[model samples]
Target: MIDRPRRLRATPAMRRLVSETRVHPAELVLPVFVREGATEPVPISSMPGVVQHSLDSLRAALVAAAEAGIGGVMLFGVPEHKDAIGSGATDPSSILNVATRVAAEEVGGALVVQTDLCLDEFTDHGHCGVLDPLGRVDNDATLDRYREMAVVQAASGSQLLGLSGMMDGQVAAVREALDDAGFTDTPILGYAAKYASAFYGPFREAVQSSLVGDRRTYQLDPANRREGAREIDLDVAEGADIVMVKPAMSYLDVLADAAASSPVPVWAYQVSGEYAMIEAAAAHGWIDRRRAVLESVLGIRRAGADAVLTYWATELAEWLR
Candidate 1:
Protein backbone atom coordinates (compact mmCIF):
# COMPACT_ATOMS: atom_id res chain seq x y z
CA MET A 1 0.00 0.00 0.00
CA ILE A 2 1.08 3.56 -0.76
CA ASP A 3 2.14 5.69 2.21
CA ARG A 4 -0.61 8.07 3.26
CA PRO A 5 0.50 11.32 4.91
CA ARG A 6 -3.19 12.13 5.38
CA ARG A 7 -3.22 9.79 8.37
CA LEU A 8 -1.26 12.28 10.47
CA ARG A 9 -3.40 15.21 9.28
CA ALA A 10 -6.67 13.39 9.91
CA THR A 11 -7.24 14.85 13.38
CA PRO A 12 -6.78 18.17 15.22
CA ALA A 13 -5.38 16.28 18.18
CA MET A 14 -2.67 14.71 15.99
CA ARG A 15 -1.78 18.06 14.44
CA ARG A 16 -1.42 19.68 17.84
CA LEU A 17 0.79 16.88 19.12
CA VAL A 18 3.29 17.21 16.25
CA SER A 19 3.42 20.99 15.95
CA GLU A 20 7.09 21.99 16.05
CA THR A 21 6.95 25.70 16.79
CA ARG A 22 4.63 27.34 19.30
CA VAL A 23 3.79 30.93 20.05
CA HIS A 24 3.32 31.88 23.68
CA PRO A 25 2.09 35.07 25.32
CA ALA A 26 5.38 35.45 27.19
CA GLU A 27 7.36 35.27 23.93
CA LEU A 28 5.65 38.23 22.27
CA VAL A 29 6.76 41.83 22.61
CA LEU A 30 4.52 44.73 21.64
CA PRO A 31 5.81 47.79 19.80
CA VAL A 32 4.09 51.06 20.72
CA PHE A 33 4.38 54.70 19.70
CA VAL A 34 3.92 57.68 22.04
CA ARG A 35 3.72 61.12 20.46
CA GLU A 36 4.61 64.19 22.49
CA GLY A 37 1.89 66.81 23.21
CA ALA A 38 -0.92 64.58 22.01
CA THR A 39 -3.99 64.87 24.23
CA GLU A 40 -5.71 62.05 22.36
CA PRO A 41 -4.37 59.02 20.55
CA VAL A 42 -3.74 59.78 16.89
CA PRO A 43 -4.69 56.94 14.58
CA ILE A 44 -2.16 56.28 11.86
CA SER A 45 -4.15 56.24 8.62
CA SER A 46 -1.89 53.85 6.77
CA MET A 47 -1.72 51.41 9.69
CA PRO A 48 -5.47 51.15 10.27
CA GLY A 49 -5.93 50.55 14.04
CA VAL A 50 -2.45 51.46 15.30
CA VAL A 51 -2.19 54.84 16.98
CA GLN A 52 0.42 57.37 17.96
CA HIS A 53 -0.51 57.57 21.58
CA SER A 54 -0.75 60.44 24.03
CA LEU A 55 0.75 59.99 27.50
CA ASP A 56 -2.59 58.93 28.99
CA SER A 57 -3.24 56.63 26.05
CA LEU A 58 0.28 55.20 26.32
CA ARG A 59 -0.29 54.41 29.98
CA ALA A 60 -3.48 52.60 29.08
CA ALA A 61 -1.66 50.57 26.39
CA LEU A 62 1.08 49.61 28.84
CA VAL A 63 -1.54 48.33 31.26
CA ALA A 64 -3.21 46.38 28.44
CA ALA A 65 0.11 44.78 27.39
CA ALA A 66 0.81 43.71 30.95
CA GLU A 67 -2.70 42.31 31.36
CA ALA A 68 -2.36 40.34 28.15
CA GLY A 69 0.79 38.71 29.63
CA ILE A 70 3.12 40.02 26.97
CA GLY A 71 6.75 39.65 28.03
CA GLY A 72 7.76 43.16 26.94
CA VAL A 73 6.80 46.40 25.16
CA MET A 74 9.15 48.31 22.84
CA LEU A 75 8.49 52.05 23.02
CA PHE A 76 9.05 54.63 20.26
CA GLY A 77 8.50 58.31 20.88
CA VAL A 78 7.37 60.88 18.30
CA PRO A 79 8.81 64.19 19.38
CA GLU A 80 7.13 67.50 18.53
CA HIS A 81 10.48 68.89 17.48
CA LYS A 82 13.36 67.63 15.34
CA ASP A 83 16.94 68.75 14.67
CA ALA A 84 20.14 67.95 12.76
CA ILE A 85 21.65 65.93 15.60
CA GLY A 86 18.41 64.45 16.97
CA SER A 87 19.04 66.29 20.21
CA GLY A 88 15.86 65.11 21.90
CA ALA A 89 17.06 61.50 21.72
CA THR A 90 19.66 62.18 24.43
CA ASP A 91 17.72 64.80 26.37
CA PRO A 92 16.55 63.60 29.78
CA SER A 93 13.37 65.65 29.49
CA SER A 94 12.61 64.33 26.01
CA ILE A 95 9.21 62.80 25.35
CA LEU A 96 10.67 59.32 24.85
CA ASN A 97 12.41 59.46 28.23
CA VAL A 98 9.30 60.87 29.86
CA ALA A 99 7.20 58.09 28.37
CA THR A 100 9.73 55.46 29.48
CA ARG A 101 9.49 56.73 33.04
CA VAL A 102 5.72 56.62 32.77
CA ALA A 103 5.80 53.04 31.49
CA ALA A 104 8.14 51.95 34.28
CA GLU A 105 5.86 53.54 36.85
CA GLU A 106 2.80 51.84 35.42
CA VAL A 107 4.08 48.32 34.69
CA GLY A 108 6.97 48.08 37.20
CA GLY A 109 8.70 44.73 36.73
CA ALA A 110 5.58 42.89 35.67
CA LEU A 111 6.70 43.43 32.06
CA VAL A 112 10.02 44.31 30.48
CA VAL A 113 10.05 47.94 29.24
CA GLN A 114 12.17 48.44 26.13
CA THR A 115 13.03 51.67 24.35
CA ASP A 116 14.14 52.38 20.76
CA LEU A 117 17.48 54.12 21.03
CA CYS A 118 17.45 55.32 17.41
CA LEU A 119 17.51 58.92 16.19
CA ASP A 120 15.22 58.43 13.17
CA GLU A 121 11.96 59.51 14.78
CA PHE A 122 13.54 62.48 16.53
CA THR A 123 15.78 63.68 13.67
CA ASP A 124 14.54 66.12 11.06
CA HIS A 125 16.27 64.20 8.28
CA GLY A 126 14.71 60.97 9.57
CA HIS A 127 18.05 59.19 9.37
CA CYS A 128 18.96 56.73 12.12
CA GLY A 129 22.06 58.73 13.09
CA VAL A 130 23.70 62.12 12.83
CA LEU A 131 24.99 63.24 9.43
CA ASP A 132 28.27 64.99 8.84
CA PRO A 133 28.93 68.04 6.64
CA LEU A 134 29.04 65.85 3.51
CA GLY A 135 25.45 64.72 4.27
CA ARG A 136 26.46 61.11 4.93
CA VAL A 137 25.70 59.33 8.20
CA ASP A 138 28.64 59.94 10.56
CA ASN A 139 29.06 56.66 12.43
CA ASP A 140 31.58 57.71 15.09
CA ALA A 141 29.75 60.87 16.04
CA THR A 142 26.47 58.98 16.25
CA LEU A 143 28.04 56.49 18.67
CA ASP A 144 28.65 59.39 21.07
CA ARG A 145 24.96 60.27 20.95
CA TYR A 146 24.11 56.60 21.54
CA ARG A 147 26.33 56.52 24.61
CA GLU A 148 24.56 59.47 26.22
CA MET A 149 21.15 58.17 25.16
CA ALA A 150 21.91 54.82 26.80
CA VAL A 151 22.60 56.41 30.19
CA VAL A 152 19.40 58.45 30.00
CA GLN A 153 17.26 55.48 28.94
CA ALA A 154 18.77 53.33 31.71
CA ALA A 155 17.99 56.11 34.16
CA SER A 156 14.41 56.22 32.91
CA GLY A 157 14.13 52.52 33.90
CA SER A 158 14.14 50.87 30.50
CA GLN A 159 15.20 47.29 31.16
CA LEU A 160 16.35 46.74 27.57
CA LEU A 161 17.56 49.15 24.91
CA GLY A 162 16.62 48.31 21.33
CA LEU A 163 19.70 49.52 19.50
CA SER A 164 18.26 50.18 16.03
CA GLY A 165 20.56 52.95 14.87
CA MET A 166 22.72 50.67 12.62
CA MET A 167 25.83 52.59 13.64
CA ASP A 168 29.19 50.82 13.70
CA GLY A 169 30.59 50.25 17.20
CA GLN A 170 27.30 51.41 18.71
CA VAL A 171 26.73 48.24 20.75
CA ALA A 172 30.13 48.37 22.40
CA ALA A 173 29.90 52.12 22.95
CA VAL A 174 26.49 51.91 24.58
CA ARG A 175 27.54 48.91 26.71
CA GLU A 176 30.61 50.75 27.98
CA ALA A 177 28.55 53.84 28.76
CA LEU A 178 25.94 51.82 30.65
CA ASP A 179 28.60 50.09 32.76
CA ASP A 180 30.38 53.34 33.56
CA ALA A 181 27.11 54.88 34.70
CA GLY A 182 26.51 52.01 37.18
CA PHE A 183 23.85 50.42 34.94
CA THR A 184 25.61 47.07 34.83
CA ASP A 185 22.43 45.06 34.70
CA THR A 186 20.79 46.88 31.78
CA PRO A 187 20.74 44.73 28.63
CA ILE A 188 21.07 45.61 24.92
CA LEU A 189 18.80 44.22 22.22
CA GLY A 190 20.81 44.86 19.07
CA TYR A 191 18.94 45.20 15.79
CA ALA A 192 21.86 43.45 14.17
CA ALA A 193 20.42 42.52 10.78
CA LYS A 194 18.21 45.50 10.03
CA TYR A 195 17.95 46.05 6.27
CA ALA A 196 17.26 49.11 4.18
CA SER A 197 14.02 47.94 2.65
CA ALA A 198 10.88 49.39 1.09
CA PHE A 199 8.84 47.36 3.62
CA TYR A 200 9.21 50.14 6.19
CA GLY A 201 6.80 52.47 4.37
CA PRO A 202 4.02 52.25 6.95
CA PHE A 203 6.46 52.76 9.80
CA ARG A 204 7.60 56.05 8.26
CA GLU A 205 4.02 57.32 8.36
CA ALA A 206 3.40 55.98 11.86
CA VAL A 207 6.40 57.90 13.19
CA GLN A 208 5.68 60.95 10.95
CA SER A 209 9.14 60.61 9.50
CA SER A 210 10.80 63.54 7.72
CA LEU A 211 13.11 61.43 5.62
CA VAL A 212 13.92 62.87 2.21
CA GLY A 213 16.30 60.10 1.20
CA ASP A 214 16.77 56.38 1.69
CA ARG A 215 18.80 54.87 4.55
CA ARG A 216 20.89 52.63 2.26
CA THR A 217 24.05 54.24 3.58
CA TYR A 218 23.89 52.53 6.93
CA GLN A 219 21.28 49.75 6.95
CA LEU A 220 22.11 46.30 5.63
CA ASP A 221 21.43 45.64 1.97
CA PRO A 222 18.64 43.16 1.38
CA ALA A 223 20.66 41.17 -1.19
CA ASN A 224 23.59 40.42 1.13
CA ARG A 225 22.89 37.41 3.37
CA ARG A 226 26.47 36.92 4.53
CA GLU A 227 26.72 40.54 5.62
CA GLY A 228 23.78 39.96 7.92
CA ALA A 229 25.68 37.16 9.66
CA ARG A 230 28.75 39.38 9.94
CA GLU A 231 26.73 42.13 11.61
CA ILE A 232 25.20 39.63 14.03
CA ASP A 233 28.68 38.40 14.89
CA LEU A 234 29.90 41.93 15.64
CA ASP A 235 26.88 42.63 17.85
CA VAL A 236 27.33 39.42 19.83
CA ALA A 237 31.04 40.08 20.32
CA GLU A 238 30.17 43.56 21.57
CA GLY A 239 27.91 42.29 24.38
CA ALA A 240 24.43 42.28 22.85
CA ASP A 241 22.38 40.11 25.17
CA ILE A 242 19.82 39.61 22.41
CA VAL A 243 20.24 40.04 18.64
CA MET A 244 17.44 40.86 16.18
CA VAL A 245 16.61 40.91 12.50
CA LYS A 246 14.30 43.75 11.49
CA PRO A 247 11.49 43.52 8.92
CA ALA A 248 11.35 39.92 10.00
CA MET A 249 9.11 38.32 7.39
CA SER A 250 11.32 39.20 4.45
CA TYR A 251 14.50 38.46 6.39
CA LEU A 252 13.71 35.01 7.77
CA ASP A 253 16.81 33.66 6.06
CA VAL A 254 18.97 36.07 8.06
CA LEU A 255 17.00 35.32 11.23
CA ALA A 256 17.58 31.60 10.83
CA ASP A 257 21.29 32.10 10.26
CA ALA A 258 21.64 34.19 13.40
CA ALA A 259 19.59 31.76 15.44
CA ALA A 260 21.67 28.80 14.23
CA SER A 261 24.99 30.46 15.02
CA SER A 262 24.50 32.87 17.90
CA PRO A 263 24.98 32.04 21.57
CA VAL A 264 22.42 34.61 22.68
CA PRO A 265 18.68 34.59 22.05
CA VAL A 266 17.55 35.69 18.57
CA TRP A 267 14.55 37.94 17.91
CA ALA A 268 12.64 39.03 14.83
CA TYR A 269 10.58 42.15 14.24
CA GLN A 270 7.44 41.54 12.19
CA VAL A 271 7.56 45.14 11.08
CA SER A 272 4.85 47.68 10.29
CA GLY A 273 4.51 47.00 6.58
CA GLU A 274 4.08 43.29 7.23
CA TYR A 275 1.22 43.95 9.66
CA ALA A 276 -0.46 46.36 7.25
CA MET A 277 -0.27 43.86 4.39
CA ILE A 278 -2.09 41.14 6.33
CA GLU A 279 -4.62 43.57 7.79
CA ALA A 280 -5.29 45.26 4.46
CA ALA A 281 -5.77 41.97 2.66
CA ALA A 282 -7.98 40.57 5.41
CA ALA A 283 -10.09 43.69 5.40
CA HIS A 284 -10.62 43.15 1.69
CA GLY A 285 -11.91 39.64 2.52
CA TRP A 286 -9.02 38.09 0.62
CA ILE A 287 -7.71 36.13 3.61
CA ASP A 288 -8.84 34.83 6.97
CA ARG A 289 -7.51 37.43 9.39
CA ARG A 290 -7.17 35.23 12.48
CA ARG A 291 -5.73 32.25 10.67
CA ALA A 292 -3.41 34.31 8.53
CA VAL A 293 -2.05 36.16 11.53
CA LEU A 294 -1.36 32.99 13.47
CA GLU A 295 0.16 31.28 10.45
CA SER A 296 2.45 34.18 9.67
CA VAL A 297 3.85 34.34 13.20
CA LEU A 298 4.11 30.57 13.38
CA GLY A 299 6.14 30.53 10.20
CA ILE A 300 8.54 33.05 11.67
CA ARG A 301 8.89 31.11 14.91
CA ARG A 302 9.51 27.91 12.99
CA ALA A 303 12.33 29.65 11.19
CA GLY A 304 14.30 29.77 14.46
CA ALA A 305 13.19 32.99 16.11
CA ASP A 306 13.22 32.78 19.91
CA ALA A 307 10.61 35.55 20.16
CA VAL A 308 8.89 37.98 17.86
CA LEU A 309 8.00 41.69 17.94
CA THR A 310 4.63 42.40 16.45
CA TYR A 311 2.06 45.18 16.48
CA TRP A 312 -0.61 42.58 17.26
CA ALA A 313 1.21 41.33 20.36
CA THR A 314 -1.61 42.20 22.76
CA GLU A 315 -4.38 40.72 20.62
CA LEU A 316 -2.28 37.67 19.70
CA ALA A 317 -1.50 37.05 23.36
CA GLU A 318 -5.21 36.96 24.13
CA TRP A 319 -5.80 34.59 21.24
CA LEU A 320 -2.80 32.42 22.10
CA ARG A 321 -3.92 32.00 25.69
Candidate 2:
Protein backbone atom coordinates (compact mmCIF):
# COMPACT_ATOMS: atom_id res chain seq x y z
CA MET A 1 0.00 0.00 0.00
CA ILE A 2 1.23 3.49 -0.86
CA ASP A 3 1.42 6.06 1.93
CA ARG A 4 -1.15 8.83 1.37
CA PRO A 5 0.24 11.98 2.97
CA ARG A 6 -2.19 13.95 0.82
CA ARG A 7 -4.95 12.86 3.18
CA LEU A 8 -4.19 15.79 5.47
CA ARG A 9 -4.15 18.19 2.49
CA ALA A 10 -7.46 16.89 1.11
CA THR A 11 -9.78 19.39 2.74
CA PRO A 12 -9.89 22.66 4.66
CA ALA A 13 -11.27 20.78 7.63
CA MET A 14 -8.42 18.27 7.53
CA ARG A 15 -5.84 21.06 7.22
CA ARG A 16 -7.38 22.93 10.12
CA LEU A 17 -7.55 19.88 12.29
CA VAL A 18 -3.93 18.90 11.73
CA SER A 19 -2.40 22.41 11.52
CA GLU A 20 0.82 22.71 13.53
CA THR A 21 0.41 26.44 13.99
CA ARG A 22 -2.47 28.87 14.38
CA VAL A 23 -2.83 32.64 14.52
CA HIS A 24 -5.45 33.94 16.88
CA PRO A 25 -7.02 37.31 17.74
CA ALA A 26 -5.62 37.20 21.27
CA GLU A 27 -2.09 36.91 19.88
CA LEU A 28 -2.28 40.09 17.79
CA VAL A 29 -1.21 43.59 18.77
CA LEU A 30 -2.01 46.79 16.87
CA PRO A 31 0.60 49.54 16.76
CA VAL A 32 -1.13 52.91 16.79
CA PHE A 33 0.13 56.46 16.22
CA VAL A 34 -1.52 59.45 17.86
CA ARG A 35 -0.65 62.97 16.77
CA GLU A 36 -0.49 65.78 19.33
CA GLY A 37 -2.86 68.32 17.87
CA ALA A 38 -4.74 66.87 14.97
CA THR A 39 -8.51 67.17 15.05
CA GLU A 40 -9.02 64.08 12.92
CA PRO A 41 -7.31 60.92 11.73
CA VAL A 42 -4.47 61.55 9.26
CA PRO A 43 -3.91 58.86 6.64
CA ILE A 44 -0.42 57.53 6.10
CA SER A 45 0.26 57.45 2.36
CA SER A 46 2.77 54.61 2.55
CA MET A 47 0.75 52.39 4.89
CA PRO A 48 -2.61 52.36 3.14
CA GLY A 49 -4.97 51.51 5.99
CA VAL A 50 -3.13 53.14 8.92
CA VAL A 51 -3.59 56.65 10.25
CA GLN A 52 -2.13 59.11 12.76
CA HIS A 53 -5.04 59.46 15.10
CA SER A 54 -6.07 62.56 17.00
CA LEU A 55 -6.93 62.25 20.70
CA ASP A 56 -10.65 61.85 20.13
CA SER A 57 -10.01 59.49 17.26
CA LEU A 58 -7.56 57.46 19.33
CA ARG A 59 -10.30 56.65 21.85
CA ALA A 60 -12.45 55.20 19.11
CA ALA A 61 -9.55 53.18 17.72
CA LEU A 62 -8.85 51.71 21.15
CA VAL A 63 -12.47 50.75 21.53
CA ALA A 64 -12.46 49.18 18.09
CA ALA A 65 -9.27 47.27 18.88
CA ALA A 66 -10.78 46.06 22.14
CA GLU A 67 -13.94 44.99 20.33
CA ALA A 68 -11.81 43.10 17.82
CA GLY A 69 -10.34 41.10 20.73
CA ILE A 70 -6.69 41.68 19.84
CA GLY A 71 -4.17 41.33 22.68
CA GLY A 72 -3.34 45.03 22.92
CA VAL A 73 -2.40 48.31 21.26
CA MET A 74 1.13 49.79 21.20
CA LEU A 75 1.03 53.58 21.07
CA PHE A 76 3.51 55.90 19.35
CA GLY A 77 3.24 59.65 19.66
CA VAL A 78 3.82 62.35 17.02
CA PRO A 79 4.43 65.52 18.92
CA GLU A 80 3.74 69.08 17.76
CA HIS A 81 7.31 70.05 18.61
CA LYS A 82 10.73 68.38 18.36
CA ASP A 83 13.99 69.07 20.14
CA ALA A 84 17.52 67.78 20.55
CA ILE A 85 16.93 65.96 23.82
CA GLY A 86 13.41 64.72 22.99
CA SER A 87 12.07 66.32 26.14
CA GLY A 88 8.55 65.46 25.09
CA ALA A 89 9.29 61.81 25.71
CA THR A 90 9.64 62.45 29.44
CA ASP A 91 6.94 65.06 29.79
CA PRO A 92 3.78 63.91 31.52
CA SER A 93 1.75 66.09 29.16
CA SER A 94 3.37 64.66 26.02
CA ILE A 95 1.03 63.17 23.48
CA LEU A 96 2.23 59.61 24.20
CA ASN A 97 1.60 59.91 27.90
CA VAL A 98 -1.72 61.65 27.37
CA ALA A 99 -2.76 58.97 24.94
CA THR A 100 -1.79 56.37 27.53
CA ARG A 101 -4.08 58.04 30.03
CA VAL A 102 -6.88 58.04 27.49
CA ALA A 103 -6.28 54.44 26.49
CA ALA A 104 -6.23 53.30 30.09
CA GLU A 105 -9.52 55.08 30.67
CA GLU A 106 -11.04 53.74 27.47
CA VAL A 107 -9.94 50.11 27.42
CA GLY A 108 -7.60 49.57 30.33
CA GLY A 109 -9.46 46.45 31.38
CA ALA A 110 -10.06 45.15 27.88
CA LEU A 111 -6.51 45.46 26.49
CA VAL A 112 -2.89 45.94 27.47
CA VAL A 113 -1.93 49.61 27.13
CA GLN A 114 1.65 49.72 25.81
CA THR A 115 3.81 52.69 24.76
CA ASP A 116 6.89 53.15 22.59
CA LEU A 117 9.71 54.38 24.83
CA CYS A 118 12.08 55.45 22.13
CA LEU A 119 13.24 59.02 21.48
CA ASP A 120 13.19 58.88 17.67
CA GLU A 121 9.60 59.98 17.29
CA PHE A 122 10.11 63.00 19.55
CA THR A 123 13.70 63.93 18.59
CA ASP A 124 14.41 66.63 16.05
CA HIS A 125 17.29 64.66 14.52
CA GLY A 126 15.22 61.48 14.74
CA HIS A 127 18.03 59.38 16.23
CA CYS A 128 16.74 56.91 18.83
CA GLY A 129 19.03 58.55 21.41
CA VAL A 130 20.36 61.92 22.43
CA LEU A 131 23.39 63.07 20.45
CA ASP A 132 26.53 64.49 21.92
CA PRO A 133 28.15 67.70 20.66
CA LEU A 134 30.19 65.55 18.25
CA GLY A 135 26.86 64.58 16.60
CA ARG A 136 27.14 60.95 17.66
CA VAL A 137 24.57 59.16 19.77
CA ASP A 138 25.62 58.94 23.44
CA ASN A 139 24.49 55.62 24.85
CA ASP A 140 24.87 56.35 28.58
CA ALA A 141 23.07 59.67 28.28
CA THR A 142 20.27 58.00 26.39
CA LEU A 143 19.79 55.56 29.30
CA ASP A 144 19.24 58.49 31.62
CA ARG A 145 16.48 59.76 29.40
CA TYR A 146 15.01 56.26 29.13
CA ARG A 147 14.91 55.96 32.90
CA GLU A 148 12.98 59.21 33.14
CA MET A 149 10.72 58.25 30.26
CA ALA A 150 9.93 54.88 31.84
CA VAL A 151 8.70 56.36 35.08
CA VAL A 152 6.56 58.95 33.29
CA GLN A 153 5.06 56.38 30.92
CA ALA A 154 4.30 54.06 33.82
CA ALA A 155 2.76 56.90 35.78
CA SER A 156 0.66 57.76 32.74
CA GLY A 157 -0.86 54.29 32.85
CA SER A 158 1.27 52.37 30.39
CA GLN A 159 1.12 48.75 31.41
CA LEU A 160 3.95 47.72 29.11
CA LEU A 161 6.87 49.90 27.99
CA GLY A 162 8.49 48.91 24.72
CA LEU A 163 12.19 49.81 24.76
CA SER A 164 13.03 50.02 21.08
CA GLY A 165 16.01 52.34 21.35
CA MET A 166 18.68 49.61 21.14
CA MET A 167 20.78 51.45 23.64
CA ASP A 168 23.15 49.52 25.92
CA GLY A 169 21.89 48.94 29.47
CA GLN A 170 18.44 50.34 28.64
CA VAL A 171 16.43 47.45 30.00
CA ALA A 172 18.25 47.50 33.33
CA ALA A 173 18.01 51.28 33.58
CA VAL A 174 14.30 51.40 32.75
CA ARG A 175 13.53 48.45 34.98
CA GLU A 176 15.33 50.08 37.88
CA ALA A 177 13.50 53.33 37.25
CA LEU A 178 10.12 51.64 37.17
CA ASP A 179 10.90 49.82 40.41
CA ASP A 180 12.22 52.93 42.13
CA ALA A 181 9.10 54.80 41.17
CA GLY A 182 6.83 52.19 42.72
CA PHE A 183 5.75 50.72 39.40
CA THR A 184 7.17 47.26 39.97
CA ASP A 185 4.13 45.73 38.40
CA THR A 186 4.78 47.47 35.08
CA PRO A 187 6.61 45.43 32.43
CA ILE A 188 9.21 46.13 29.76
CA LEU A 189 9.20 44.71 26.23
CA GLY A 190 12.68 44.83 24.79
CA TYR A 191 13.09 45.17 21.02
CA ALA A 192 15.96 42.73 21.40
CA ALA A 193 16.91 42.09 17.79
CA LYS A 194 15.73 45.18 15.94
CA TYR A 195 17.70 45.40 12.71
CA ALA A 196 18.81 48.51 10.92
CA SER A 197 16.92 47.52 7.82
CA ALA A 198 15.49 49.10 4.70
CA PHE A 199 12.19 47.61 5.90
CA TYR A 200 11.58 50.62 8.18
CA GLY A 201 11.13 53.08 5.30
CA PRO A 202 7.35 53.38 5.65
CA PHE A 203 7.60 53.70 9.44
CA ARG A 204 9.74 56.82 8.98
CA GLU A 205 6.90 58.39 7.01
CA ALA A 206 4.22 57.20 9.43
CA VAL A 207 5.93 58.91 12.39
CA GLN A 208 7.03 61.95 10.32
CA SER A 209 10.62 61.15 11.25
CA SER A 210 13.35 63.77 10.89
CA LEU A 211 16.15 61.22 10.75
CA VAL A 212 19.29 62.64 9.19
CA GLY A 213 21.28 59.40 9.10
CA ASP A 214 20.92 55.65 9.45
CA ARG A 215 20.62 53.92 12.84
CA ARG A 216 23.38 51.45 11.96
CA THR A 217 25.45 52.56 14.93
CA TYR A 218 22.91 51.19 17.36
CA GLN A 219 20.52 48.83 15.59
CA LEU A 220 21.84 45.39 14.78
CA ASP A 221 23.29 44.58 11.38
CA PRO A 222 20.67 42.65 9.42
CA ALA A 223 23.25 40.18 8.16
CA ASN A 224 24.21 38.89 11.61
CA ARG A 225 22.04 36.06 12.96
CA ARG A 226 24.13 35.08 15.99
CA GLU A 227 24.24 38.67 17.22
CA GLY A 228 20.47 38.66 17.28
CA ALA A 229 20.52 35.73 19.68
CA ARG A 230 23.07 37.53 21.86
CA GLU A 231 20.89 40.63 22.11
CA ILE A 232 17.97 38.52 23.25
CA ASP A 233 20.10 37.00 25.99
CA LEU A 234 21.35 40.42 27.08
CA ASP A 235 17.85 41.92 27.27
CA VAL A 236 16.53 38.95 29.18
CA ALA A 237 19.38 39.21 31.68
CA GLU A 238 18.72 42.90 32.02
CA GLY A 239 15.15 42.26 33.15
CA ALA A 240 12.87 42.40 30.16
CA ASP A 241 9.44 40.92 30.72
CA ILE A 242 9.04 40.23 27.00
CA VAL A 243 11.43 40.16 24.06
CA MET A 244 10.82 41.01 20.38
CA VAL A 245 12.37 40.30 16.99
CA LYS A 246 11.43 43.04 14.57
CA PRO A 247 10.56 43.05 10.85
CA ALA A 248 9.37 39.51 11.46
CA MET A 249 9.23 37.67 8.15
CA SER A 250 12.84 38.20 7.13
CA TYR A 251 14.24 37.34 10.55
CA LEU A 252 12.42 34.13 11.31
CA ASP A 253 15.64 32.27 12.05
CA VAL A 254 16.63 34.74 14.75
CA LEU A 255 13.08 34.77 16.11
CA ALA A 256 13.08 31.00 16.29
CA ASP A 257 16.30 31.08 18.28
CA ALA A 258 14.85 33.68 20.64
CA ALA A 259 11.63 31.75 21.17
CA ALA A 260 13.57 28.62 21.97
CA SER A 261 15.93 30.15 24.52
CA SER A 262 14.25 33.14 26.10
CA PRO A 263 12.41 32.61 29.36
CA VAL A 264 9.91 35.38 28.69
CA PRO A 265 7.29 35.81 26.00
CA VAL A 266 8.70 36.18 22.49
CA TRP A 267 6.97 38.57 20.11
CA ALA A 268 7.56 39.74 16.54
CA TYR A 269 6.79 42.99 14.80
CA GLN A 270 5.46 42.89 11.23
CA VAL A 271 7.05 46.23 10.43
CA SER A 272 5.87 49.07 8.19
CA GLY A 273 7.84 47.95 5.16
CA GLU A 274 6.41 44.45 5.38
CA TYR A 275 2.90 45.89 5.60
CA ALA A 276 3.52 48.27 2.67
CA MET A 277 4.91 45.55 0.42
CA ILE A 278 1.85 43.38 0.91
CA GLU A 279 -0.59 46.25 0.53
CA ALA A 280 1.17 47.58 -2.55
CA ALA A 281 1.38 44.17 -4.17
CA ALA A 282 -2.28 43.53 -3.50
CA ALA A 283 -3.16 46.87 -5.05
CA HIS A 284 -1.42 45.73 -8.25
CA GLY A 285 -3.31 42.41 -8.04
CA TRP A 286 -0.09 40.44 -7.90
CA ILE A 287 -1.39 38.15 -5.14
CA ASP A 288 -4.53 37.31 -3.25
CA ARG A 289 -4.41 39.85 -0.39
CA ARG A 290 -6.30 37.92 2.28
CA ARG A 291 -4.44 34.68 1.71
CA ALA A 292 -1.07 36.40 1.64
CA VAL A 293 -1.73 38.29 4.85
CA LEU A 294 -2.93 35.19 6.67
CA GLU A 295 -0.04 33.09 5.43
CA SER A 296 2.56 35.72 6.26
CA VAL A 297 1.46 35.97 9.87
CA LEU A 298 0.98 32.24 10.23
CA GLY A 299 4.55 31.69 9.05
CA ILE A 300 5.76 34.05 11.76
CA ARG A 301 3.75 32.18 14.38
CA ARG A 302 5.12 28.89 13.13
CA ALA A 303 8.61 30.31 13.50
CA GLY A 304 7.79 30.79 17.22
CA ALA A 305 6.53 34.28 17.97
CA ASP A 306 4.15 34.13 20.92
CA ALA A 307 2.45 37.29 19.64
CA VAL A 308 2.72 39.51 16.59
CA LEU A 309 2.45 43.25 16.31
CA THR A 310 0.96 44.15 12.93
CA TYR A 311 -0.97 46.99 11.32
CA TRP A 312 -3.48 44.32 10.23
CA ALA A 313 -4.20 43.32 13.84
CA THR A 314 -7.79 44.51 14.13
CA GLU A 315 -8.82 43.50 10.62
CA LEU A 316 -7.06 40.14 10.93
CA ALA A 317 -8.61 39.54 14.32
CA GLU A 318 -12.05 40.21 12.89
CA TRP A 319 -11.37 37.71 10.11
CA LEU A 320 -10.14 35.09 12.59
CA ARG A 321 -13.31 35.45 14.61
Leading candidate by lDDT: 2
Displacement of residue 253 (Cα, Å) in model 1 is 1.0
Candidate 2 structure quality by residue, lDDT tens digits, 1-321: 599899899999999899999999999999999999999999999999999999999999999999999999999999999999999999999999999999999999999999999999999999999999999999999999999999999999999999999999999999999999999999999999999999999999989999997999999999999999999999999999999999898899999999999899999999999999999999999999999999999999999999999999999999999
**Model-by-model lDDT, in order?**
0.94, 0.96
Q: What RMSD value applies to candidate 2?
A: 0.7
Residue 281, model 2: Cα distance from true site in angstroms: 0.6
TM-score of each: 0.98, 0.99
Question: Candidate 1, residues 1-321: lDDT per residue as tens digits?
Answer: 699888888899998987778999999999999999999999998888899999999999999999999999999999999999999998989999999999999996889999999999989998988898999999999999999999999999899999999999989999999999999999999999999988899999989999998988899999999999999999999999999998889999999999899999999999999999999999999999999999999988999999999999999999987
Cα deviation of 279 in candidate 1 (Å)? 0.8
Runs with alpha carbons beyond 4 Å of true place in candidate 2: none
Clashes of 1: 0
